[model samples]
Target chain A: MRTNLMMTAAAGAILATGMTTAAMADGHATDLTLCWAAWDPANSLIELSKDFEEQSGHTMNFEFVPWTSFADRMLNELNSGGQLCDLMIGDSQWIGGGAENGHYVKLNDFFDANGITMDDFLPATVTGYAEWPKNTPNYYALPAYADVVGWTYRKDWFERPELQVEFMDTYGRALDVPANLAELKDIAEFFQGRDIDGTTVYGAAIYTERGSEGITMGVTNVLYNYGFEYENPDQPYDIDGFVNSAGAVEGLQFYKDLYDVGTPPGSSNWYMGENIDAYRSGQVAMQMNFAFIWPGVEADENVGGGNSGYFPNPAGPAGQFAQLGGQGISVVAYSEKQDAALEYIQWFAQPEVQQRWWDLGGASALRAVVEDPDFATSQPYAQTFLDSMAIVKDFWAEPAYADLLIPMQERMHNFVIAGDGTAQEALDGLVRDWIEVFEDEGKI
Target chain B: MTYSPIDRAAAKTPDGVARRIRGLSDRTIAWIFVAPTIFLLLAVNIFPLIWTIRLSFTNFRVNRPNNAVEWVGLRNYERILTDPDVWNTMQATAHFLIWTITLQVLIGFTLAYLINKKFRGNDLWTTIIVFPMMLSPAVVGNFWTFLYQPQIGLFNYVVAFFTGVDPASFSMIGDVHLAPWAIVIADTWMWTPFVMLICLAGLRSIPDSIYEAAECDRASKWRQFWTITIPMALPFLMLAVLFRGIENFKMFDLVVQLTGGGPGNTTTLTSIDLKREAFEKWRTGYSSAYAVILFVTVFGLASIYVKALNKVKER
Candidate 1:
């Protein structure tokens, strides 16, 4: 009986300690879980969240997954009712389906209540990723990281007077940054198989990953520049013309031609990692990638410090265009801590915090912060990226966008790697498959 | 009444013992012994299988779980059956299975036969021959990928020296026609040693009396090999084929690392395609059907092969 009484006393003490700790953490609404792509930038965001924690007095947990598994992981977490995350950084392409499926917390009321206006963000960033439809009032998320397609080139190679003279003599123009696809191809061909600085280098490197989003990201630049649209303006999935349009075929053919003459052998199997390695190793004269790679290119001794230059994707006959590639912070609709998650977003959206984010090599989504001279001067390529952010166009903002993208990616990889079919044939096949997906989903 | 109590106590002892003995039937006792195992099987195997079978008939997407699940009946199965791309993938898988199993059996048997003869360093030779199977498949796949690299890869360097073709011009993974063969070759290289070990065990189990009897009969070495050794090892060889066939049918990790089912789905086996659908596309119900088909095919084939192996053993 004495031992039992002592055990009861010990249990009481333990329960009291637990209750006290809970009370300490309980004043603020609840705990919030945030998910994002695992990378150095993600680490920086985690470091920056300490101030939010102090001010809000709410505990925040983070779940970081690799880019390859980010979407699938988030979807599974939400589906399983697993309480895996309260807030997530989702790919832009996922916003439509995510909103339609009710995975995201509708943020319009929260924005209104907080006196937060979406106009405070870059218009393209806001509409492209955060809004459900173009310029729609039903916002499902807030733009967290705004990225767009851009190109990096070897400035040192282009500046060589002798090479410039030879290039001009061969192409009948002074060698400069390409203003169009034709010029880009000409520059690529000129530098192909050239021995520079006692090392052999190729002209360009592009991703051709058969699985995941590699091909989509790489091919969209050409597709959009050549006026490829996912659907008709009047009807969904009625892409008979835009998908297999003559200009789009020309664009695909141009990519294939560039691969044939300018890319290093085995380039067809390259992905993002390969692109980064090739550029860092100085084996390629140019690389087309998103803004996320800028910091890596700038910091890496082999590619960044003094050897790199950035440019917007060259214009095509139709118009100047770049594919929008960015991520947004969405609160999981199933989260028990919705209020705390919203408070975190509000805290994160503050201009002062965003400026600190910029100082830490983060891409800012706020127009006010991004336009600040102080933020622009934080890094060398910040202003360049801020300028390019103006012209970005996102493809397929519908719920069935992922389904439409799969067949397109497969066909693109087939065209580039196997050369099994003409660009027109591949694009026509994509149009058929995409229409099927849309029809099945009742989106058309 | 006093006398009845004493008699009742005497009857009770033997009656109680007999009742206890009769209560434990052989089947009941046996079940009691295996109850834990039976419970485990139900928990781990039967539950998931029933769940998956149910899921296979529904239209479910991982991303849109809250949406209503529609019953598609056999729609997924019919689509898989008629799809040309799926058929092509099956053909690739069959080609890989046939080539790798044939190569592994032939080479493994030869190695085992040679090692069975008591020569200098015979034990050492046996250990060295089985080393490849001991390493992880992922490690083997990564190493072989390096060796197949077109420019600086050792295989390409050696081939280049003989053929004078630019090593960098050809890609093993990028070529649709060559990617499947690359996977088959790597699998055969790693697994042949397993077949060799099985063959070695079979060879050892055959008594020296048979060879001695053949010698007494004045049979030639070739005659003895054909009449005695081959017959004795047939059962083990068939067993090896059964094991290897079932394994190669579901081949995934090595091929995923090597070619990633790329070059336009040319090297995509059914397993790779199923993974792409289920995980990558989040089409859970569709891929569940795909998985069920794969399961049935493998299970059906393995059952027939096992029966044949039993027949061989009986002979």
Candidate 2:
């Protein structure tokens, strides 16, 4: 009798789970809106989503804001529990807030019900984009794009025999792709203020923008490789020595040095757009930007078609690492059309659809697409994208990421761009700021 | 007998309506008509002010509804007062206010004086001079950024032509020292015409007969100018200052579009800093305290200035 009772209870639980899953799978056509930054990839996604709309019978609406205001605008919409965006391709750092604040619909059950396994996606993207308490199986979003900070150099300039000879003579080595940050600096210095084709050109265009995340993203590419850990590996939020380590200071100092000696005049407030402009206009020999701009660089009339070459962020003394730049698509919790939203996500997860997304210029985070043998040869920057994504690190994804990020942006801009203080002092101040934030959050 | 329209309409009214109308007082009818405007004032202006004051005393984040709000009392106020960074922001704001006001007053008064003297095509020149002021601040900020661009900008080229410094050497918006002045220059360009117009009105309002009487007394042109011109325009000039003082205190879009308060915090005015705190960082409670402090400062200063202006008017 007890055995029968146990079996009946199990059967009832199964039936209840099925009913819940069935409730969201209600066959209905509805309008679904996806929010993301206005960029090349946004246009690509709009094109790619048409297939999903056709297949799922749900209308796809897009709300794309420029990168400058994207974070402020979308975060406001999410914070207010606004139902404007049924889906959001939010920044990776927003995962903690989205999951903890319950702005995102937890997608584990949906993934399971639809047989969408996380293993099929890139591990880095899975950890960076999906997991909230991170390294846990609890999922909030599916990785929509794979991006990392990388370098794009003027290949035509570097390949010129006369320039190469002069570079080699000055540096006592053949100027090829930099194997390390130190060598990258050397290359930048070599090209600094050099005349190219009778027009004066400058070195690399690095991110030093003070308004937003530009400097932090640029500095972290150097910081991570120089042993700047966000916190103690064993203890969370204990960032006294780890954040302001000796090597981290060296890295920060190196970045400041690069800015002072290499970058073009008036490049002090340069970000992605400025960097791209500088490179395309032949004002700079190279640019530090996200991998998403690679396709545009490859297609540009002035600097495209084998004139530009790409490379992962060069190694430093401690290790090789690049700053992760990507987003994951999460179903907004307040969305009234959950059934249609889930249907869209379901249709988006198909491998064939993922392949089409990549072909159409959207960076697919699926392993089957990126890991294929032909993927490396897919585009000029494809291999660099993969390699950079391999060595990726992301900023603090704490629920108070904005609080944490604002201080870092200020400190980094102060030290790197403004020549305000020592790198050690900047990093130490950052620790103090971050500690105060965590303390307020009851984390410490 | 012929009746006027009002008399005929009144005669046709029912006894109940006529009685109600007869019973209504002027003050009561006036209030009935004014009630909507008063209600709107309370809703839009007074309510937000009171709400902001209330929020200033608590630790409330609008984004985190689930978190328990603790009354932090004067902690937020204390933080702002003690923060060295906030003081720096204040300093930047003060610098901007002083420089922009001084430049605008000097140049604007000069232009207005020149325009007051009737010249060939004076109206045409005045229209052309006012064109900069008519353009949107956002647009001005954007175009000025290009104008300030090193090596490729007209401003740099012009400066280089005169000074013989390399156009590629120094950046207007990029240099820490120049960035503060860059914003000042742009603001003065956009708003100097506003001041010019006000000063011109003051100049035009001075009676021609007063000057003629001064001439009959054999008063020198310089003496007449200081005694008559300066005193007469003083009130209007102060009024212009008051208007500009309030507007510059909350200057946002123009500077944001130009430098974004950067090249370090060299250009970070208090308004920009407060915005970052309130919206970007979502420190609603802390920012409420900030807003209250700014409001009190502006209100207190303006009150004193207005009193001084009244005294000058009485004189």
What does DockQ give for each predicted structure?
0.45, 0.73
Q: For each prediction, how big is the interface RMSD? A: 1.8, 1.0
Per-residue lDDT for B126-242 in model 2, tens only?
999999988988999999999999968899999999999999899999888899999999999999999999999999999999999999999999999899999999999999999
The top-ranked prediction according to TM-score is: 2
True contacts kept of 2: 0.67
**TM-score per candidate:** 0.90, 0.95
Return the lDDT, model 2, position A164: 85
Off by over 4 Å in 1: A1-32, A57-60, A374-378, B1-22, B119-129
Q: What is the C-alpha local distance difference test score of each model?
A: 0.81, 0.91
- Residue lDDT tens for model 1, A295-408: 989998777776788888888888878888888898888888887788778777766666667777678898767766566666767776876797788877677666777777
Query: Per-residue alpha-carbon lDDT of model 1 for B145-199, expressed as tens digits?
Result: 7778774578777778999988877877778777878888899989999999889
Candidate maximizing lDDT: 2
lDDT of 2 by residue, A255-351 (tens): 9999998999888888899999999999988899999999999899999999999999999999999999999999999999887788778767766
